[model samples]
Target chain A: MRMDLDKQLNGSVQKAFLLLEAFTLDKPEWGVSELARSLGANKSTIYRLLATLEKLGVLQQNRRSEKYRLGLKLFELGHRVSIHQAVVHCTHPVLEEVARAIAETVHLAILEGTHIRYLDKVESPQGLKISTEIGSLRPAHCTGLGKMLLACADSEQQQAVLDATPLFAQTANTIVSAAALRRELAEIRERSFALDREEYEIGLICVAVPIFNQQGDLVAGLSASGPANRFREEALPHYVSILKRGAEKIREGIGNFQL
Target chain B: MRMDLDKQLNGSVQKAFLLLEAFTLDKPEWGVSELARSLGANKSTIYRLLATLEKLGVLQQNRRSEKYRLGLKLFELGHRVSIHQAVVHCTHPVLEEVARAIAETVHLAILEGTHIRYLDKVESPQGLKISTEIGSLRPAHCTGLGKMLLACADSEQQQAVLDATPLFAQTANTIVSAAALRRELAEIRERSFALDREEYEIGLICVAVPIFNQQGDLVAGLSASGPANRFREEALPHYVSILKRGAEKIREGIGNFQL
Candidate 1:
C-alpha cells in the first residue's frame, strides 16, 4: 500500500510531543491528569506518552510528587548542539576583560521560552560575590537580558510571549502590567541597553546590552551586575559603557568566529 | 473497541522526535532518506515529521545542503535547564579560590552522552591562557573529566559505550586502545582522580578529581589545566591536591540538590 504520510502521523508520535510541550518553566513538574488537561488529550493517552518519554529519559517521574519534569536527556542532546558553547565562546574573553576592568560579576544570557537563561558569567574578586547559575532560567521580563530581547523582538511575538506568561511580582520594582512592560521595552531599545533595578530579586541590579550577530540580529546579551548599592544610578553610566564595549567586542568576536 | 494506550500516541509527534534524534554530533546534518533509514520509518512519515519540527523551530533545514539538523530550540530548551547554573552555583567560589592559588585555568565538566560538556571555567591572572568554552563538548575517553566519568561508570556500561563508539585519535598521546583505556580507568579509580597528559589536545595537560553529591554519587568533575610545558609532572601532586580540594568545596556547596 502506498503510504499516506499525513495519515500515519496522526498516530502515537505526535501525541507524545504535545504531552511534552505541555510542560513549562512555571509548571516544570506535572501530574498525569494535569498533563492530560494541559494537552487537551485523554488521561490514558497522556499516561502512555509520559511512560514512553520517561523510559527514553526525555522525562523523569518524581517518585515522591508523582510529577514529571524534563529529564537530563535534553541536556545531553543540547551538549551535542553546542548552543552554550556558542554563547560562551562568543562572550567569555569579553566578560573576563569586562570583569577585570570593572571588578564586578559579568553575565551573558539569552531568552529561552519565558525565561532568560544565563549562558556565561564571570565573578568579581571581592568578598561580596554575585551568584548566577549558567543553566538557571529566571523570568525574562524582569531580567536585563529578557527586557533587552523583548525590546528587540517584533511587537506581535513580544505580546504573544508576555500574554502567555504570568508576570509574578518577584520584587516591588518589577513591571507587572503589559503597558508598563511595553513602555520599558521601548525605553530599552532607545538606550541600547536594559537594567534590572532590583526587579527580579532584592538588592541585585544588572545592566545589559544586546548582542547582535553578523546579520545584525539580536542573538544574545552581555551584562555587568552586582549589588544594587554598588551599582547605584551614579555608577550606571560607567557600567553601561563597559557593558556596551564588551557587547561590541563579543559581536566582533562572533563575526570573526574566534574561539 | 477499548483504547490500546500505546497506540493512542499522536503518531506525528513520535515520528518528529525520532527524526530529530536521527541527527547526531558526528552527522549533524542528514537528508530525508538517511533520516528514514536511521529511524526505520517510511520516507513520507519522515518528511511530515521534519516539516512539523522545522515549523516548531525544533529542527532546521540547511537550504543549501537540503539536510536537517537539530535547531536553536534545543539550545533554547537547554538554556532553560540551566545546567551551567548548577555548575556555577556549585563551583564559582571554589574555582575562584583555586585560580588564586594555582594561577591557571580551572574548569568544571560533566558527562553528557558520549562527551564531556564543560559547564564552568576560571582563568588565572598570570599564566599562559588556555581558554575553554563553557558549552564545549569533547570525547569523554581522552579528556580528564571523560576518563574520570569512565572510571566512575560500571564496567559493563563503559565497555558497551566504548564498543559502540569509534575511538578517534585526537592527539598522539590519546589512548586509542580499549585495553589501554581500561587500564587508565583502573588507575583513575584507585587514585580518585584522572589526568590528561596532552591526550585530547596537544600542549595541554589536565588533572581532574570527581565531585560527588551528599549521597557520594559522582556528580561531575573539577579540573585544573595549563600548558603541558609549564604544568610538568613535577607539579602533578600540587595540581591533584588543588583539584581535589576544589572538588570537595563544590560538593559541599551542592549538598544534596540533585536538580
Candidate 2:
C-alpha cells in the first residue's frame, strides 16, 4: 500500500527523532550502549545517528562523561515558539501579579490533544515552592487545569479525545472511570471552574478557571496551587473568586493584543 | 572515506531536521510550497516529512492557514533542559532581584558552541522594557555576556571557537577583527567584567560579570542592561557592585543545589 511505502521511506528519520525524544527531565543524558539497548538498535547505527545529530547541533556530548544530551538548538527553536504563543505572552504579567498577591504557584496551560502543555508559570518566593517546569506535559484527566480546558471542548471533540486517551489514575483521588470523568466535566462546566484536591499529587491543592479569547473560546486555564494545609476547603470560595478575577484580567489582556 | 558514505546515508534525516530548524522568531510558520522551494526539495518529500513531524507532535499545522509551526512537544523538551540547567534555575531569584533593584533588564546566559544562549531574563517593571526572550541565541562577538564567557576559555579553545564563527557586525560598535576581539577578551579577563557600549544594539548598554560553580569553573554570566541614556558612566561602579553581590548570591544558590 501507499501508506506502507511511505512508512518505509520515513523510517530512518523517525528513528533519529526517537533518539532525541528519549532524553527527558529524569534521564537527560544517555550513553551509546545504554541507548542502544533501550532502543533495541545496533550500537553502530545509534552512534552514527548521534554523530549526525551532534554535527547538526541538535545533540551534544558532555566533555567529561561522553554522554549525549539534547543540544541548545532545540532550545533556540522552542523559545521562538514560546514567544509566538499569545496565550503564554499575554499571561506573563498577570501570572506574576497573581503569584505575588496570593503567594502561591501560578500556571497558564492549554490542552494539546490529550495532554496539557504548560505555557508559562510563576512560582511563589515562599520557601516551599513547587518544582513544576514550564513546557512540561501532564495527563488531561487528573489535574485541575487539564479538566478546566477539557470541560470547554465540544461533545464530539471531547468524546474523540476521551476515546483516544487512556484514563490512568495518577493518584488515589484521580477519576479513573469514563462515566465518572464525564460527570465531573459536566459539573465543572456548570460551575465554570475546576478543582484538584490532591487528585494529581498528594498534599497539594489547586483551583483553575478557564481563560477565554475575544471569540469567547477556551484558550487556556489559569491556576493557583499551594500546599493543602494552607489551601483549606474553607478558603476555596476566596481562591476561586481571585482566580476568576485573574482569568478576566487575562482575557482582557488577550483581547487587547487581538490574539 | 567513511564520512562520505555516512553523509549519504543520513541525507534524508538531515533534510528532515533542516525543516525543523527553518522555523525562527521572524518566520515562525511556513507553507508547504514555500518550504519546498526554499529547501529545493520535491513538494512530495517536504509534505511527507511534514506529515511525519506532525504525527510525532514535533510540528503542527495551523487549522485555518495550513502553515506549519514548531509544536508543543519541542517546548516540553526545551523547558526540561532549562529546568536542569543549574545556571538558569539558580539565577532566577537573583535576576528578579537585580531587575527590581536596578530598574533595568537582567539576563543570565551561557556559551553554547559559538553563540550565547540566554538561559533566563527578567525585565524592568518601568515603562521602558527591553525585549529579549529566554532560549534565544546571539552572536558572541557583540554581547558583553558573550565576551565575558569567551574570556574564560583558554587560548586554544578560544581560537577554535573564533575560527568556526563569523564576526558579523551586529552594530557599528561591534568588533569584527580577530586580533581586536582577542585583545578585548584579555582586558575582560583582567578587569573581571565585560562592558558592551552599544556594541550589540545601538542606544543599549550592558555590563556583565562571570558566574562560577563550586569548582570555580566559568559557568554563566549575569548581566544588567538598560537604555544608554539612563545607564550613566559615573554610576557604573555602583551597578557593578550590585551585580557582583547578586552573582555571589547565585553562586551560593548553585552551591546549595550541589550542581
Candidate 3:
C-alpha cells in the first residue's frame, strides 16, 4: 500500500514538502536513512530528494555530521512572502514601542486553525524573560493573545475552532472547558482585553488586545508578557491602554489587510 | 530543449523549486499564464504545480487578482532554520542594544556567495533610517559590513569572491576597481574597522566591525548606519566601541559556530 502511495499521487512537489515537514524546531536535522524510515518512503528516493533540496539550497548538510537541516534560502524566500512585507513590517516597530513602554516582552500573533502562531516579538530589555519564538505555535485556549484573537472572531469561526481543538488544560488557570471558555471569550469581547494568569506556563502572565483593520475585521492580537510576580492587578489598565495604542498604530499603518 | 529538459532531470522537486523561485519580492504575485511564460513551462504543468502548492499551503491565491503568492507555511519553515535559531537569536538583542545606545540603525550581516546578506537589524528610534531588510542580500563591495567581512575572510576565499563579483559602482564613492577595493580591504584589516563613506547610497554612511567565534574565525559583521549629515567624525570612537562591544557579546554567545 505504501509502495503504491508514491505512484498513485501526482507526486514530486508533494513529496518534497512532506520531506521538509519532517524537519521541525524540535528536530531540525535529519540523516537520510532516518528521514526515509520516518516518512515510510524508500531510501534511494529519500536520498535523491535530499540531494535535490541540498543542491537548491532549501536544505544543507552539516559537513561533520552528514545530517541535513533547513538552509538560508528558505529564510530568504520566507522574508519575501508578501504578507510578511505587508503586515509584520508595520507591526514590528509598534511591537517594539509596546515592549519599551511595558518593559516586558511583546508579541503579535494570529490564530491558525486551533493554535496561535507568533508572527513577531520584541523582547524585554532586561533580557529574554519569555520563551516564545517567532513563527512558533502555542495552544489557543491558554494564551492571552489567543483568547483576544478568538474572542474577536465571529461566532461561527469560534465555534468551528472550538469544535476542532481539544482545549486541553496546560495549568490550573487555563479555561479548558468549552462552556467556560465561551464565557471568557464573551467577557473578553465586552472588556476589549484578555489576560493569561499563569495558564500556559506556571509563572508567566500576559495581557492582550485585538488589532483591527479598516473594515473592523480582527487582524491580530497584540500582547505584553512578563513574570507573574511583576504582573500587578493595578497595572492591568496601563497594560491594556499601552497594547491598545500599539494595536491602533498597527491598524493605521496596515491598510485593509487580512491574514 | 525545454521539453526534453524535464525528462532529462529527475524532475518533480526541482520543477517545484524552479516554480517557487519565480515568486520573488520584486514580483511576489504571479498568474498561471505569466508564470508559465516566464519559466518556459507548459500552462497545464504550471497550473497543476500551482494547484498542488496551493493545496499544500506553500502558495496562496489572491482573491481579487487570482494570482499566487508565497504563503505563511514558508514563513513558518524559514524561522525553524538552525542558523536563525542559533545565530540571529543571540545577535538580535545585541543589535537592539547597539541601536538604542548609538541612536542609529544597526545591522548584523554575513557574506553569502559574493554578496553580504543582512541577518538581523534594529531600526533607529528616530525611524527606519536604513532600508536593509533581514535575509536580504546587497553587494559586498559597497557597504561597511561587506568590506569588514571581506577583509577578515581567508585570502583564497577573498580572491575567489573578488574574481567572481563584478565591482560595478553604486554611488560615486563606490570603489569600482579591483585594485582599489583590495587596498581598501587591506586598510580595513589593519584598522580593525570599516566605513562605507557613502559608497552604497549618496546620503548614507556606515561603520562596521567583524564578529569572531571562540575559534577566532570570522562569524558576522556588525554595523550601525545613519544619514551622512548625522554622522560626525568626533563620535567615531564611541560608535566603534559600541559596535565592538556588541560583536564581542555575539562572539561569546556563538562559541565555535561559523556562518
Candidate 4:
C-alpha cells in the first residue's frame, strides 16, 4: 500500500516545492487556495503537500486564518547550515584575531542568491556594541561585503545580477547609479578591498576584503565595521591593511579545510 | 518539451521527502544507494528526488564524499523561523532579572527528542564565567532543565526514554537507576522545582522550574546555575523562589501573546 502511494505521489514534488517557494519575504503566510493559485497547482495537491510539510515541520498552519507560514524546523536547519563547523571552524578564530587587532566588529559573509548573508560576527571588546545577527541578509550592491563579492564576480554574472535588481538608494551616501557601482567595483578589484561609506545605513562605515579558496576563487568576504567617526578616511589605509591580512589568514585556513 | 517534462516529473514529491528522511544525526550524510535501500525505494526514484532536492538546496552533495548531507537552505529557512525570537522574547527580561538578583547565569531550555536544547541564556555580572551556546543540546535526565521536563512526562513515556539509551555518567553525583529517578521526580513535583547537584558536570549546581502555557501544559523550563561553591544547600530556597518567579513571568508573557 505504501509503495503504491509513493508511486502515485511521485510527480508532485516540484509542485510542492513551488508552493513553498511562493511563501517569501512579502508573502510570509498564505491560505490554501491562494498557495495553489500562486504555484499553478490544484488545491487538493497543495493541501496534501502543505499537510505533509507541516507534519515534517517545514510549514506551520495558523489555526485562526488557516494560513500557512514557514516553520521553526527551517530555522533549526538554517542555523545548522550557517554554523556548519566547516564555516565556523575556519572563520571564528580568524574573526577573533581580527576583532582584537582592529578593535571593530569583524564579520564574515557569503552570497545567498542576490543578497549577502552574514555567517559570523565578532565584536570589539572596547567599543560601543554594533549588534548584527547571523543569517541576516543585506543587499549585495550597497554593502562592503557585497561589493567585495561583486568585485570578484565575472562581468557577465555581475551584469546579470545588476539587471535583475533595482539599485535602490539606502542612504544619502549610497551609490544608486549602475555607472557609479561599476566604477566602485573596478576600484575595489584594483585595491583588493571594498568600502561602504554609509551606503547601507548612515553613520556606519565598513571595510571588507575577499577570502579565496585554494583555487583562488572567492568563497566569502571578511569585514570590519564601525561608526564613521571611528573609521575615518585617514584610518582607511590601516583598516584596509588589517582587513586584507585577516582575509589572507582566513583564506589559508579555508585551504586547510577538508570540506 | 518543458510541459511534457513537468508532467512526467509531477508525481515524485513524496518519494523525495522519504529520501530526505533517510538522513539523520547518526546518518547525516548518505550515498544514493544507501538512501534508496533505507527508504525501500528504487535507486532511480531516489536519484531523481535527490537531484531535485539538490537544486533546491534542501540536500547538498558533498563533492569529495559523493554522499548527500542536509543543505544550508534548510538552515536559512530555520534561522527565519522566529523560534529564537520566541525564546529571546520570552526569556531575555526574565534572564536579566534573575541574573541580576542572584548574580548567576540564568537559562531557558526546551526538550528536543532526548536532549535539552538551551534556547537562551544570560551570564552573571561576576564570578566564574559560565559559557553555553544558544542552540547547544545536552542529554535529558542529566541537567536541571532536562530533569524538570522529564519529571513532567508520564511514567511509560519516562521509561521509554530512559530504557532506550546509554546513561553515560557525566559526574559522580549522576543518577542512573529508574527507581531512584522516579523518586527524584516525585520530590521535584512536590517541591515544584528540580535540582542538579553536579549531576551533568562537577562543580556546577543548577535549579529549575517548569514554564507552562495558557493551557497549563509544560512548554519549557527556566533555570539558574552557578559553581557549587556559590549555590550551597542553604541558598537553595532563594534560588528556587527566583527561578519559579521567572517561570511564572514567562508563562504570563506566553499567555498574553496575541499572535
Candidate 5:
C-alpha cells in the first residue's frame, strides 16, 4: 500500500509539471479540455490537478477566459533558485561594468542543449541596443555567446547538439552548412572568441568570450552586442580585452560554483 | 478507480509542492531525511518525491553536499510566468526611466500578505544605492512601496493582515504598533503617497505612490529610494509629483492586469 501511494505521488508530481510546461510564451493560457486533449490526458484528471495547483498559487485561473496560466508562485520559486544567485548575481556587476565601458548591451549565458540560455543582461544606455529578455533562449549556432560556449563544449556534446538542432540561417551571414559550422567552432576554440556579424539578426552584431572557473572549466559566455554599424573592426581587439577581463572577474567571483 | 486515482494524484501534487516549498532562500539545500523530518512525513515518501523532482530537474542534488536545491528548470519556468511578462517586462522600462531621472533606486512592488514582493527594480547609477534584490520580500509597514500598497488595500484585507502579522520594527523609526501603522496608512491614503525616512534601514529613505490600473483599482506601488542624507524635505513635493507621474505611466501600460 505504501509503495503504491509513493508511485501514485510521483506520478501526480510528474503530471503536474507536464501540465505547467504546456503554458509557454507561444500559448500562455490553457483551458482544461484543450490542455488534456493536447497532452492526451483525461479531462477530469487535468481539472483536479489544476485545482490543486491553483490552491498552491502555482497556477491561476483567468476570470474572463476561464483558462489556467503559470502563476507568480513560479516567479517566486524562480527567485529562490540557487543558479540565479550563484551565477547571475555574482557576474551581473561585471556585465554592468562591461556594458558601461563598451556602451553596449552585455549578456551572461550558459549552454543549455542546442541553445544558449541568457542568465543575466545589462542593456546599453544608448537609444538602440539589443533587447533580449533574461531567461530567454536563443539558437547557439547563430549567436556569439552560443558559439563561444559551444566551442568550449566537449566533442560528444557539440556533435549531439549539432545533430539534434538544425542550423537554420537567420541572415545571409548565418553558417548554414554543418561542416562550415564545425570549422567556425574550431577557429573560435583556437582564438578563444566568437563574433556574430549579422548572423542572428540583420544589423545586430555580437562578440563573446568564454568565462572559465578557477578549475579551468568553461561555465558561461560573456558577450557585448550592439548595432553592426557601431561595432567597428578596430574595436574588436578592445572588446575582446574588456570582456576577457570581465570574464576573469567572474571566474574569481564564481569560485567553484556549478550551473 | 478513476475517483481514487484522482484523489491520490491531487494528494501527491500537494505533497510535492509542500516538499518544494521547504527549499527556501534561507535554506536552499535539503537532504531527504532532514526534509522528511521537517515536513513530518515518511522518509520513503519524501525520498520518492525528491527523486521524481530531481529527475524532472526541478531540483538538483549537489555533488559534494548530497543535498537537493532548486534547479534551472524552476528558473526557466519563472521566465514563462505571465506576471513577469504582464507586469515586470511592461513596467521595468518605466522603472529604469524613473531611476535614471531621479538618480535613485526604483522599485515596483505588490503587497503579499504582510510583505511586499519586489516585482522589478532599477538600481541607481550612483556608487551608494539601495541593494535590495528583485523577488525579495520586505516588511510592508516600513517601506514606501509597501505602505503605499497597503494603504490602498481594502479595509478588511488591511485588518486581516494587521491581525495576522506582528508589526516588528526594523529601525527606531519603523511603525511597530498596529494602531500607529493604521494611522500612517490612513494618512498615506489621504495624501495619495507614502514615505519611508530611515524606517527600514538606517541610511535609506524613500517615496512611493500607488499605481492604479485602467479600471481605477490599485495594482502596484512604485517607489524611489536614496540615501537619507540626499532625500531633502524641500524635495518631498517633487518626489511625490515624479512618483505620481510614474504611477500614471504604469496605469497607462498595465490596462486591466491584476497581480
Candidate 6:
C-alpha cells in the first residue's frame, strides 16, 4: 500500500500525515526529538512538519512543555463531519428510543474498509452499561455489527477485506477462521441480522441488523448490546426484533442523507 | 507570522493544509481540476496532495464524480480531541444547566491565539436559538465571550493580538477602534463580565463571564445569548448572576483539567 501510494502521493504530504498519526489519546503530546525517534525520521524533518501543523492549527504546542498535541481545528472539522453524515443526525432520536426500550446500549456503525466505525451510540439506562466512543473501530470478523455489514457486502469486498485481516481471537467464542466467518456471514444474510455471544468481549453479547437505504443498499448497522448474563438466550428474539425495527427506521429516514 | 513560520514550516505541508481547508460544508466536494484552479496550484501538485490525503483517509474521493471531500479519519481524530479537552468535559453539565435556567443558548469558549474557540454549547429549549459549532473560531474583538477573555489577557499578550487584529465591524454596534476596545476591556475587567449588545450580529445580545481555575487563572468564558429584544438591559442583572454562578462552578471543578 505504501509503495502504491508513494507513486501518487507527494513525499511531504505523506510525512505530514505520518506526523498527525503519531498523536493518540494515550500519547497525546510529544516533544520533537522524542517524536522523531518514534517515527524514525530526522529531527529537522519532524520539527518542520510540527511547525507546519501548528501554523495550520491542526496541532498545538503546549507553552510549558513544548510538546505537540492535536489542535481545535480538527475538533471543529470533526463536528462538521458528525452533522454532515446526516445518518447520525437522522437516527439519534430513534437510537435513544431503542436504547431506552431495550434497556441496552444501542450503537450505529458504518463499514469502513475492513472495520466497523462506531458513528453514534446511546448508553443503556440500566446500571450495567456497555459503552464505546464514537469513531472507535473494531475488526469486522468478531463483532455483531461487523458481521451484519460483512454479510451484506459484495463477495469481492468481503474477500479483499478477509484476505488482509488476521482473525485474531478476542475471546473464546470468536470465530477465528475465514471459512467459519464466511459460513456465519451466509447465515446472517439469510436471517437479515447477526449476533455475537461474547465474541468481541468477555461477558458481553450483541445483536445487530443491517440498515439499508431507500434503494435497498446496506448503509450501516444498528446494534443492541448488554452483559452476557442479562442478555440471555431467551432475550435474543426480542433484541433482534427491536434492532431490526430501529434499523428499519434509520433506513426509512436515511434515504435522503448523502452519507 | 507566515515569514517567521516559513523558516521551519515546509511548503508542501502548508499546501496540504490549504487542500483540507478548501472543503467547507457548502462545498464539501471538489474535482481535482476545480480545486487546483481555486488554490492557484498546478494540476500535478494538487493531484498528489489529494492522493496523499485520500490514502491517509483524511479525505475521501467520491467514486462517481471523483470529487474529494473530508473523510472519517478527521472525524475520528476530532472526536478524540473533544474528549481530551478536559475543560469541555468538566463544563458541559454546567452549560446545559445554565442554558435551561436562562432559557437561552449557553456557550463555553477558550481563548485560542487571537480568537475565541467555542468548546461547548447548550441550545435554548425555546424556538429561538444561537447555535454554533463546537470548534468554530471567531474574532476576540466583537463577541461577548471573546471580550471577556481579552479583558483578562496579560498586557503583552493583549497588545500582540490587538496589534495584528484589524477589528473589522460585524454590525453597526461593533467597537472597531483599538482605543475603544481597550476601554471596553477595562470596563469588563472592573465589572467582571462582558456584554455584546448586537455587536457581533443584529438582534442578538450576549452576556459573558470569565471562568477561572482553582489557582485563579482565567481559563474560559461562559456566556448566555438570546435575541436582543428578549435579553434587554432590564434582564442584565439576572443573566450576569446566573453566568457568574455557572462560571464559579466550572472554576471550582476545572482546576484539575489540563486544558
Report the lDDT of model 4 for residue A231.
Answer: 68
**Positional deviation of residue A257's Cα in model 1 after best superposition, in angstroms:** 7.5
Q: What is the DockQ of the complex in model 1?
A: 0.30
TM-score of the A-chain for all models: 0.69, 0.90, 0.91, 0.71, 0.84, 0.89
lDDT of 4 by residue, A45-127 (tens): 67777877776667788998888988755554554452354676457768878888899999998876567888777776665
> How well is each residue in A161-217 modelled by candidate 1, as lDDT tens digits?
679545788899988888888889889999888999899889988888888876688
Whole-model lDDT for model 3 versus the true structure?
0.86
Inter-residue clash pairs, candidate 3: none
lDDT of each: 0.74, 0.80, 0.86, 0.75, 0.86, 0.82
Candidate No. with top lDDT: 3
Off-target runs (Cα >4 Å) in candidate 5 are A1-9, A93-105, A122-133, A162-179, A197-205, A213-216, A224-258, B1-9, B93-106, B122-133, B138-143, B162-182, B196-206, B213-217, B224-258
C-alpha-based local distance difference test score of model 5: 0.86
Q: How many clashes in each structure? A: 24, 0, 0, 18, 0, 0
Whole-model lDDT, candidate 6?
Answer: 0.82
Local lDDT at A26 for model 6: 73
Question: For candidate 2, lDDT tens digit of each residue in A88-136?
Answer: 7667878888888788999988887677878888887787777677887
TM-score of chain B of 3: 0.91
Badly placed stretches (over 4 Å) of model 3 are A1-10, A100-104, A124-129, A165-177, A197-204, A226-235, B1-10, B101-103, B125-128, B171-173, B201-204, B227-238
Q: Write the per-residue lDDT of candidate 3 for residues A1-259, one digit (tens) a residue.
A: 0533233334777888878988998898999999899888888888888888887789999999999999888888788877678888888888989998999999998887777988888889886579877877898789998888889887776886678545787988888778888999999989999999999989999999999998888898999999988879998998999999999999999879987
DockQ ranking from best to worst?
A: 6, 5, 3, 2, 1, 4
Best by DockQ: 6
lDDT of 4 by residue, B1-259 (tens): 0111123223355456545545655568888888777766677767777876777677788898898888766655555555554555556767878888988988888876677878777777786977665556788878998889888766765776578545667888888776777788889888889999899989888999998877787778888889988867888898888887888888788874322
Q: In model 4 chain A, where is the ten-residue run with the lowest total lDDT?
A: A1-10
